[model samples]
Target: MMNHSMSAATNVMKTVIYIVCIFFAVLSIFPFWIMFMNATRGTFEIQQNSIAFFPSTHLISNFKILTGKSFNPLVGFMNSMLISSGATFCAVYFSSLTAFALVAYSWKMRQPFFTFIMAVLMIPAQVSGIGFYQFMYRIGWTNSLWPLILPAIASPAVVFFMRQYLLATLSLDVVNSARIDGSGEFATFNRIILPIMKPAMATQAIFSFVFSWNELFRPLILLTDNEKYTMPIMVSLLRGDIYKTEYGSVYLGLSLTVLPLFIIYFLLSKYIIEGVALGSIKE
Candidate 1:
């Protein structure tokens, strides 16, 4: 009788947990559903009923309006793709290299260098925005994508995350073994360490990509030419004024802006799960 009651209580608890999970899942998906639905609706309809769940037949119309304005979806997509991809590559590769150096090499200044990186990470980007922009301007890099892409190499946050990941996952024995086998530092890093760090790299790649994709302030400040405008800037431009803002077109543009992020997340989501699982395991 006690066993049966315990079983029943366990079942009840699981059911409650499942219910809670489903509820939160729906809550998380609700905003994306509304945004996509609103992209298909007319501005008047959206303004009238903002919480609409049903999709409308005005998708083409919204697209037409978006294109009729200064927004070029294709150009914006290509530019954002280029910038974000470049930034992600620089951030992940360099950060991983830096972390590997900190972990694999025994140097006098290693801890101090890491502490400096942590110090930089604690400093917000906005704090140095003015100085960074001035430096870029002085270098004649303003209105260019170089400033946006190249600076990602020195990403303190990525460095910190990679260092922590390396600390947890990396084994110096492996490094020494590679050395004993006559593997060059770069060769071991590229061939062995990189493969071992794949899950963590993918996780950070997704984050860095999404961050660069959604970035606006830096691009807006550094770039003046419309040809260099990113997706976020294009979306911002869609809002002409309070009175003339086309809600449908703006939503459509926003939906387009967010599509790549969803694609990237889905592609790298498995790595995130793997990273979490790997981190949980004990030697």
Candidate 2:
């Protein structure tokens, strides 16, 4: 009788938990569903009915408006892809390398160097915005993608995350073994360390890619040409004037911008889950 009672209680608890999870999952997906629905709705329909769960019939019209004369979603998509991909690549690889150096090498000033990086991490990017822009301007990189792409190499946050991941996963004995085997430092890092860091790298790569893709301030500040504008900037431009603001088109643009991130997350979600689970256990 007691065993049956306990089994019934356990089933009840699981049912309650599943209900809560389903509720939260719906809540999380509600916004994206609304966005997609709004993308298909006309301006008047959107204005009349604020929260649409069902898609409307104006998708083609909205797309036409969004891709009309003023803004080109294709161009914005390409530019964002280039900048985000470049930044993510540099941020992950270089941060991993830096973290590896700090963790594996017992060199003089290593602690101080790590300390310096941590200190920089505490300093918000906005605080150094003026100086960075000035330096870029002086170097004649204004109106260039290089300014957006190159600074990612020194991402303090990525460095910190990589450091924690390396501390948790990397064994100095393995690194030393590779070195003792006469492997070149770069080769060892590229061939051995990189594969080991894949999960952590994938996790950070998603973050870095999303960040760069959605970033507007720096891109708006640095880029003068309309052709070089990122998706966020183009979306912002959708709200020029009250009369000109095609609400449906704006939502369509937003939906388009969000689509790539969804695809990317879907592709790398397994790694992200693994990284989180592994990192949490390590911690």
Candidate 3:
């Protein structure tokens, strides 16, 4: 009788937890759904109705308005893709490499170096924006994507995450074995360490990519040429006069901007979930 009662209570608890999770999931997705719905509405309808759950038939019209004379979404999309892709690649690969070196190799300054990196992680990038922009301007890279892409190679946050992940998953014995087998350091990192770090890499890659794609302030300050503007910058420029703002067009651009992030998440979400689950289990 006692076991049966305990089992019943456990089931009830599980059901309640499931209900709460579903409720929060719906709440999270509701805003995105409304944004998408509003993309298919006219400026007047969007202003009048404000909140809508159902999609309208004005999607084509909204797209027309969005891509009309002044804006070229294709250029923005391509620029964002290039910058985000380069930044994500640099952040993931270099961070993992730095983490591997710190974890696998013994050196005198390793702890101090790691401590310095952590200190850097606490300092926001915006703190050095003036110096960074001045340096970029002096180098004549103000309108170039290199200024945006190159500094990501030293991402302290990614280094921290990669180091933590290596601490949990990487084994020194494997490194020793590879060295004993005459494997080069770079070869071992590329062939052995990287494959083991796939889940963590994917997780960080998604975050880095999304962050680079959505970043606006740096691009706004650096990019004077319209052709060099990223998606977020272009989207920001959609704001017209207060009385004549095109709400539908703005929402349409937003919806389009969100699409690539969705695709990236969909491609890597399984790895993200697996990485989180495995980390939890390990802990």
- Candidates ranked, most accurate by lDDT first: 1, 2, 3
Q: Cα-based RMSD of the predictions, in order?
A: 3.4, 3.0, 3.5
Q: Residue by residue across 95-132, what tens digits does model 2's lDDT show?
A: 99999999988999999998899788767668878888
The model with the greatest TM-score is 2
lDDT for each residue of candidate 3 in 88-167, tens digit (9 for 90 to 100): 99999999999987898899999999989978876766888899889889989998999889889999888878888899
Query: Model 1, range 92-172, lDDT digits (tens) per residue?
Result: 999999999999899999999988997787676688899999999998999889889998999888877787789989999
Clashing pairs in 3: none
Alpha-carbon lDDT of model 1: 0.87
For this target, which candidate reaches the highest lDDT against the unseen true structure? 1
Summing lDDT over every window of 10 consecutive residues in candidate 1, give the lowest-scoring window.
274-283
**Candidate 2 global lDDT:** 0.86
| Cα error of candidate 1 at position 243, Å | 8.4
